[model samples]
Target chain A: MIKVYKELNNILLVNLNIKEASLENGDAFKAEVIKLFDKYHKSIAINMSAVEYIDSSFLGSIVSVFKHLISFQADVVLVGLSKDITNLFALTRLDKVFKIYNSFDEITNQ
Target chain B: MAQLASKQFLLPNTRQSIKASVQEVLDFVINSLPAGVNTEGISFKIEVIIIELLTNGIKHAGTIETFLDVTINEDNINIDKKDFGNRFHPGNITSLLVYDVGHKELLTKDGLHSMYAVVESDTQIRFVCEEENGDEVLDVSNLMEHFGLLIITKSSDTFTYEYDVDTGLNTFSVIIDLN
Candidate 1:
C-alpha cells in the first residue's frame, strides 16, 4: 500500500510503506502505481524510506511502471533509498535511468 | 576447520515460502556470527543474495522441492542449495538468453561447456556475447534486463554451480566473507 500526496506544480508524491518489496507484492505495487499514473499524475516521485530490500521481481515491476509511464510522456523519480537498496540500483545501473533524490524536501524544494 | 554452526531446510515450491526462508537464513546468520562482524551490511547482502538465488531457482527450474544448507565458520558463510529440476548450465548469460530465444549458434562458442566451467573459473561469464555474423557485441540493456545474476555475482564473494544431467540435480554454492 502507498500513501499519495500532491505537491505544488502537480508533482505526485507516493510514499511506500512496505518493509520488503519483493515478488509477493510487486505486481500489486505496480498496479497501484499504474492507477495513479492513469489518473494523469505526470510527475511522480516515489518515497522509498520504508523499503529496506527489493528483489528482481520488484525491480522488474518498477521497470514496467517506468516503461508504461514513458508511453504517456510522464516521468518517475525515486527518493530516500537506504544504502543497500541504493547499492542495488547502482549495481543494476538503474541509477542512470531514474532520477534519485536524497529526500522529499530535496525533490520539492527544487 | 570445524563449522561454528550449520542449518539446512527443504525449500518449498511456493513463492510465499521465499520470505520465510530469507527470514530463517537471516536469523541463523545473525545468531551465528561472532562479535565484531559488520552485521548490518552483511545481513542486507545476504538477504538480497538469498532472495535472488531462490527466486531464480523457483522461476526458471520449476523446482518442486529443494534443499538449502547454511554453514558459518570464523571467516566465511557458506551456502549450498540443491534442486531436482531441469539440468542447469551456468554459462555466459548471453548464451542462456540465446538458448531461450531458440538460437543455438552461440551456445557452443560463448556458453560454458558445463557447470564445471563456472566453478573452475570462479566467475560466471556475463555481459559478453556475439552477433550472428561472428561479431562481438556488448549490450548494456541486456545486462540491465538480467540483473538477478548480476546481483548474485556482485554480492557473493565466491559463487559456483554444478549440475548432474543424469540425476537432474542443480547445485549452486556461495561463500560470503564475514571478515
Candidate 2:
C-alpha cells in the first residue's frame, strides 16, 4: 500500500510498503502524487525507507512526480538508504539526479 | 571497508545477453549490500548503462568473440569491456572500461546531478535533470536527456567518465554512497 500525507502546507510525505513498486501500485501512486502536488503549496518529500525493491518503471514514476513538483517550483527530498539501493542509484547515475539526505533531520534542515 | 570479492564475467557483446547479465550481476551484489535501501535508483541506472554499453559493444566493438568483464568488490566495481569495432580507426581489438568507484562526488557536471535517488525506511528521492554530467552522450535527444550516460548520472552518488577516442569504446562509471 502507498500512503500520502500532507504537512505544513509545503511538505508532502509519501510512504510505500510493498515488495515491488510494480505497475498496479504505480498507477495508484501516480494518481495520489498528482493529487497531493495539486493540493499542497510546498515541496514534497517521499519516504522510501520501506520500499524493498524498485524497477525501471518505478524509477520513472518517481521522476515524473518530481518533475511535476519542480515545475511548480517545489522540490522533493529523499532520506535514509541501504547500500544495495544506493548502488542502483550509482549504477543508473540516478545518484546524480535526486536530492538525497542521510536522515530525516538532513532533509528537514535543508 | 567490507571485504568485497571481485568477480568478472565476460560474454559476447550482445544486447539481449548484456541486459540479462547485468540484472544477474546486480542481484547478487546488491542483495548483499543492505536491506532498507530503495532498488528504484539502482535499477534505473543499471538499465541505462547496461543497454547503452552492451549496444555500443555489439555495434561499435564487434567483439562477438571476446567477453565483457565486470569486476565487483564492495562499493567499487570495474567493468572492463573490449571490442573490435573501435572507432579507433584501425579496426583492431579495442578495450573500454566502465568503472563505478562508488565514492562521493558523483556528479561531474553541476548542481544536484551527482546526488543519486535512494529509497530507505525514511528517505524517498526524486532524480532531477539539473544534476547531470558536464559531457552528456545521451543529450543527443533533449537539452538534458542523454542517450546513454545521462541516465546513469541520476542513479548514483559519484560519476567518472573515461573514453579514449583512440579506442572504439567508452566507459561511464559512477559511485554512490549508500547511507
Candidate 3:
C-alpha cells in the first residue's frame, strides 16, 4: 500500500510503503504515480525511506516514470534512499539524472 | 583457500519467497563474517545483487524454483544461484543494460563516455559483437528486455553464467572479495 500526502505549496509526497521494490509491484507503483500526475499534480516527491531495497526492474520503472512526467512538464524527486540504494543510483549513474534528497526538509527548503 | 561457512537454500519463484530467501542469505553472510570486518557495505551490495539476479531469473527465465548457495571464506564470499528455466544466451552481460545504444553511436566518444559511467572498468566488461561475412553485427534486441544483468556485473568482484541446454538449468555465479 502507498500513502499520499499533500504538503504546503502543493507538493505531493508519495510514500512507497513497500519493503522490497521489485518486478512484482513496480508496475503498480508506476500506475499510482501516473494517476497522481494525471490529476494535475505538477510536483511529486517519492518517499523511499521505508523501502529497504530495489531491483533493476523497479529502478527502470522509476526512470520510465521520470521520462513520462517530464513530457508532461511535471517533476518527481526521490527522498530518503538508504545507503545501499544511493550506491545503486551512483553505480548506474542515475544520480546525475534525478533530483534526490535525504529528507523532506531538504526538498521543502529547496 | 579454507572454507569458513557455507549454506544453501531452495525457494519458490514467487516474489515473497525470493524476499525471504534474500533476507536469510544476508543474515548468514553478516553472521559468518569475521569480527572487526565492516559488514555494512558488503551486506548491502550482496543484498542488492541477490535481489537483482533472483528477480531476473524469476521474471525472465520463467523459473518455478531457484537455489541459492553461499560460501564464505577468509578471502572472499562466493554466491551461486541456479534456476530451472530458459537458457540465457547473451555473450556479454553488460550489453543487457546498454543494448539500446546503436552500434554507430557506441563508436562515438560520447557513447563511450556514457558507457564508462555504468561500467567502471573496460577490462571487466565484455561485448560480444560478431562479424557476419564482413560486417560486424550484434543482435541483442531480445536481450535488452532486462537490466538486472548490468547491476549484477557491477556489484560483484567476479561474475559468470552457464546454461545447460540439456538439463534446462541456468546458473549464475558471483564472487565478492572480503578484503
Best DockQ goes to which candidate?
3
Q: Which residue runs of candidate 3 sit more than 4 Å off their true CA positions?
A: A7-11, B91-146
User: Candidate 3's error at B154, in angstroms?
Assistant: 1.2
lDDT, each prediction: 0.72, 0.52, 0.71
Evaluate every candidate with DockQ and list the scores.
Answer: 0.36, 0.06, 0.41
| Winner of 1 and 2 under TM-score | 1
Ranking by lDDT: 1, 3, 2
Tens-digit lDDT track for model 3 on B44-117? 77888888778877766786888889999989999988887876645334333333332221211111011222
- Model 2 chain B lDDT-worst window of ten: B117-126
* Residue pairs in collision within model 3: none
Per-candidate Cα RMSD to the true structure, in Å, reads 6.7, 12.6, 8.0
Query: Which parts of model 1 have CA positions greater than 4 angstroms off?
Result: A70-73, B89-143
Which of the two candidates, 1 or 3, achieves a greater lDDT against the reference? 1
Expressed between 0 and 1, the share of native interface contacts present in candidate 3 is 0.46
B51: Cα error in model 1, Å? 1.2
Better of 1 and 2 by DockQ: 1
TM-score, one value per model: 0.75, 0.43, 0.77
True contacts kept of each: 0.36, 0.05, 0.46
Clashing residue pairs in candidate 1 (N, C-alpha, C atoms within 3 angstroms): none
